[model samples]
Target chain A: MTEEPFRWLEAIANRRDYVQQQIGTGSPVFAVSLEAGILLLGVGSGQSKVFEIFDRQAMAALGHPADIERVRQMLIDAAHLEAFTRASADVNVRRLVSFGLSPQLKQSFEQIFQAPFMIDLLLGEVAEHPSKDVLVKVNFDGGFKIQHGGVMVAAPKPEQVTLATDWLKANLDQKLKPESAALVLLLAWNSLTSGTPLPEKSEQPVKLPDALVEQLSDKVVEAAVLERKGSNVARYVPLMPLLTG
Target chain B: MNTGIAGDFLGLLAQNNLRPLAAESSTRAPEQTHATTVFAFRFRDGVLVAGDRRATAGNVIVADDVNKIIEIDRHSLLAIAGVPAMAFEMARVMQVSFAYYRRSQLQPLSQEAKVRALARLLRENLPLTLQGVGVVAPVFATVEAQGDKVVPRIYFYDPLGAQFEAVAFAASGSGSGTVRSVLSFQERFGEVKPSTMTLNQAIRFAHNVLTVASEFDAATGGVDPLRTVWPVIKVLDANGVRDVEAAEHLDARKEGV
Candidate 1:
């Protein structure tokens, strides 16, 4: 009977390995708080990877299509209900992660009888200024951190995520316009996906390959921004035109 | 629980059995606060929606600064002429619902869906409407894109939730009888049709219609010239809702400026 507990633990470990393997091949999604707004960049294979969750909040996820869509719908339902029952301004990232999504994800992950979610997501909320922008990275196990500013990355492996964020911390310019920011994101993506080591912090940032830059016009790029100076209450805008222009 | 993109805010609320209110006893109704005098008309630029700033309770004037014209979204305006509490709540729900639909579905709700959403809310409020305490007759105005061009569309609803499309204009509340008469007569015999009037002329015509209503109905506050408070007027065009400047809509100048 005592061996049963150990078997449960072993099962949990096996589940983690299985989920990680399923997600290992997915691309990384990036979010950077810029002077223009919070820029979210994600590349998808015909499916959308970036979504606007509310007026001031957006998300980018790399996971199974069904899992990503489920989380998207769940967040949308909760956000609209909160704005309806309370006020729009009351809907913030902290409450959503702390009181809503984190708990739901934790429960799903820990429950022995249910399948776990295979998703890693980055949620970005724009504020009146860049310093106060709320950027969060949520893992499949429901763990997250509130990145007040700077940049965030969601990748299949924790080591890849660490390398990319460390590299971004040294090189990213927060004031880049949408087009320039997208190029920076592509460079980080290239290093992560190609398994190439990024240059040292003191070294110049690397340029994206010519073939990859040419492939951007094919529309695989899904990008959006939460505008800081927007007049409308809903500030999320698709940035495809800005990037291509 | 998974409503997906086809889900609606109100439907989600209903699935959770979260109706706005529980039906209390309809008997022994009290004197509830009511708003009065709201109208809309098609103009050359687009549509003009206006409302008097008045709320009354029983035979007494309760407030003079109650704005009845509510902006539902960028492309729509809702003007209520009945119970202020109920109407305002309905307007708030509509505003949030429209935004929720667009965000979740990644597209704006169709115009037909928008109108039907309002009708559903009014029908749900039928219990209160029958109690003589929550009757609301409202006018809704929007601009529809027909091909490359946009046209103004106005609709009015009865207390029972029946909606009718207005050919040229719509009016509601205790003062509606007067507003309808003047607008109808002017449309046929005035110097210009209401549809042909420019934005400047439409501003004057809106003030005249509400002013005439105030003279006939005690509930309508009309234009408060003493306080230099003009009616709340908004213009809806292809670009969306824009507030008419006081200088454009109000004829009188401030004391010395």
Candidate 2:
């Protein structure tokens, strides 16, 4: 049997695909899990939804019964990713990188999943280090590529080389805040699924206020609420925008 | 020391048919010379790993100068807070294992790999931990180079061998409760952000926390300025790991800077 981590990722992807097929259109979901915090955004069938990612039961359905407890613990850990983020709020991104799955565990996961588990880390500027932000992408094949002042895509080879690359380059170049990053990713996904021309530039840049962004959708609002509740202190504000209208 | 072994150090140990001392002991005895109070947190430059120099046997203090913080490698630090002997042995095995990996693979083990290796070792010693002969909660950390930037990471482990990657800070041992309370209070109300603390501030904060722990917990030791015996304080970052000297520690306390 495959390892729990591998099984869990596969199960989530499979379930996501099933959801998209059932809705009869592309549901491009983008998720970022940091420490125990999770942010998931989905655009499906002309509607955008923001919600939490996988649950233990959903994962259990795809794997062995005995592995349920272990998988549950792993998911619980993932849920606490935000707490970790909050705790390390003063830390530079370089030190934060060490607080993830070990290389040995990653190897085990890769062996079981038959693909590399990619890590795309976005690091902010540190005073002692260089002034530039960095995006480090570790491929599934155990190799990694570093990008300074560029974009990264994790889709299939064709999409990554074609549509995704074009959209990111044309639309995104400047340093992006969390909300802007989420917006750009969602917009890119919409363009990819709809085969619409990538916007070369915006006449009036999209402006999303923290309060209005919080009221985007129930799913997005819930995500924000959950994050605030989990930390027991309001440290993180999940970017939620009403894109459906 | 065994030679002519292949693969990592752990693999080499298995090849030599060697089992941990805990695995050999069938009769469980409640031996409790446990070390206490160790933690690590990220600072401006890298991560600061600190531990009080105290070990206790039941109700009696056995050693006051026990160095609980062990440097596992150039980039990695391990702070153990349980059975002193077991913790020391675990640190030794980790050092050897890491060296073996580097020697064999011609490259140092990544921070993640070091964390996992230690976790597995602790997991294998769980039986002893359960028997109260080898209970150890450890914080392992390292600094890595990503692009031109250096990142410091910290991980906390349980007696069951479960590894947790602490995002900003982690604490373990007998006085861990007190230490954590102090940390939480600082995070909630402290003027400086815990993650953004400078090296001097982090060292001072750690000292203050350990001093608080020493007040209530007999096993936890406080700073001894007169004796020049302070907590084992070390910092790991882009420059490398280095122990905070006694003189500097004394100066920090005197100046309150």
Candidate 3:
């Protein structure tokens, strides 16, 4: 059986893992100017979930943790407006996302006295008229690019992208199921953390079970701990009941 | 970091050796072309702002298609009179100011705040207005959120930036007297309530007033069907500000005007 049925869950898990990695690193290495960190949009369905990751390091650098919390609260307060279905038909979703973030960024500039920080966003949607599945990358400066039928990464180094793309090409088929897509992303994350060489391609791509995927996610977190703390131990935040239940 | 985006903007301007206009200036330039006859009124949903297309230098008609209505943001509209150039510049700056605030703050300004900001800009331009070289009268209109409902707020400003909030309607420029008279007549005898008038009725009323102003005042240009150069009319409501296109004016044009 293909992993198509579990794609949404996998996408959410992928975002959670990526955010965890960034937080573990204690640096905003993955910060993009795309408003929220990641967004999963069901194209024609108009269903979407936004994963907003607040960068502790970035906020700490700004010397205003309270301000960061305030910004997050503001985002939560305005989350309804940021919903995909709330966007006007004439307006592009990516532009709407930028618009949603503009007020907070403006306020930060006014109150925090810092330059605009980068916001990263990933948008998944199904396009009508043309009838295509699309994933869009959006930046804080209201810039965006569209991607189709592949895993797209934002704010990654050249080497990381090269490795991730290599794994993606080798493993992903034209009709990518959610689990396989998540596995490909996991392999890329594994490569990034392990600094290991890319794996050789086999005739049949390996299938990753949900349990194994979780284990691999844990491994990625462990690697982050080793890199940051010189140990193989790390603490993981439990998934929110709203998300897990 | 900064107390507000406005302060930062001023700081940046000063850093670049630019200064905002003072309440009074020491020097004045020669008289320039000034636009006339812009007005706005509160209606059922929001506010309707209308402006004549004529620009005049004394008695001479300098231009016949000057747009006096400007949308500062999605929710706010500005109708300008007096020095066309200065008014346009003020509108442009106001647009950027609102956008900058929204972009940096990630939220739109309240309607009252927007009107106050425009008034402050006008006050800063007082020096030029005092010299009679850059006089501009602007009527600002916006729809504001209050509790569960939204209401329209309109304000008109003088050369020195004194802002007056209008409960029902406001008018400015050379043809204001004629427009005011028409508005007063409509309020006194017209069967329709000004506040309860539908969007269509409000627009037609503004057009009729402007048409009358054109008959009495050369500075107020009436509708030109052949050229399709109608007055700038905009509506600011729950859906935001949008131009009432010239095509929409076809049905609103007065007969035998």
Leading candidate by DockQ = 1
Fraction of native contacts (fnat) of each candidate = 0.54, 0.00, 0.00
Give the i-RMS of model 3 in Å.
Answer: 14.1
**lDDT tens string, model 1, A1-245?**
22598877887788789889999999999999999999999987788899999889999999999889888888888888888888889998888888889888887887768889899999999998999999998888788899887999999888988988888887888777766777778778878887766755422333556756665566478888899996677898897553432
What's each prediction's TM-score? 0.92, 0.50, 0.59
lDDT of 2 by residue, B137-224 (tens): 8998898899999989989988898988888889999899998888878877889967789877888888898989989888888776
lDDT of 1 at B78: 98
Q: Tens digits of per-residue lDDT for model 2 on A39-90?
A: 3344332222332211110110111222222322332233233222232234
Docking class of 1: medium
Give candidate 1 regions above 4 Å deviation. A1-3, A196-209, A217-219, A242-245, B2-5, B226-228, B247-257
Residue B179 in candidate 1, Cα distance off native in Å: 1.7
Question: Of 1 and 2, which scores higher on TM-score?
Answer: 1
Q: What is the lDDT of residue A186 in candidate 2?
A: 57
lDDT of 1 by residue, B51-127 (tens): 99889998899998888888898899999999988899899889988987887777898888888878888888888
- Evaluate candidate 2 by giving its C-alpha RMSD to the native, one decimal: 16.2
Model 3 quality (TM-score): 0.59
- Model 2's CAPRI class? incorrect
DockQ sort, best first: 1, 3, 2
Residue A154, candidate 2: Cα error in Å is 52
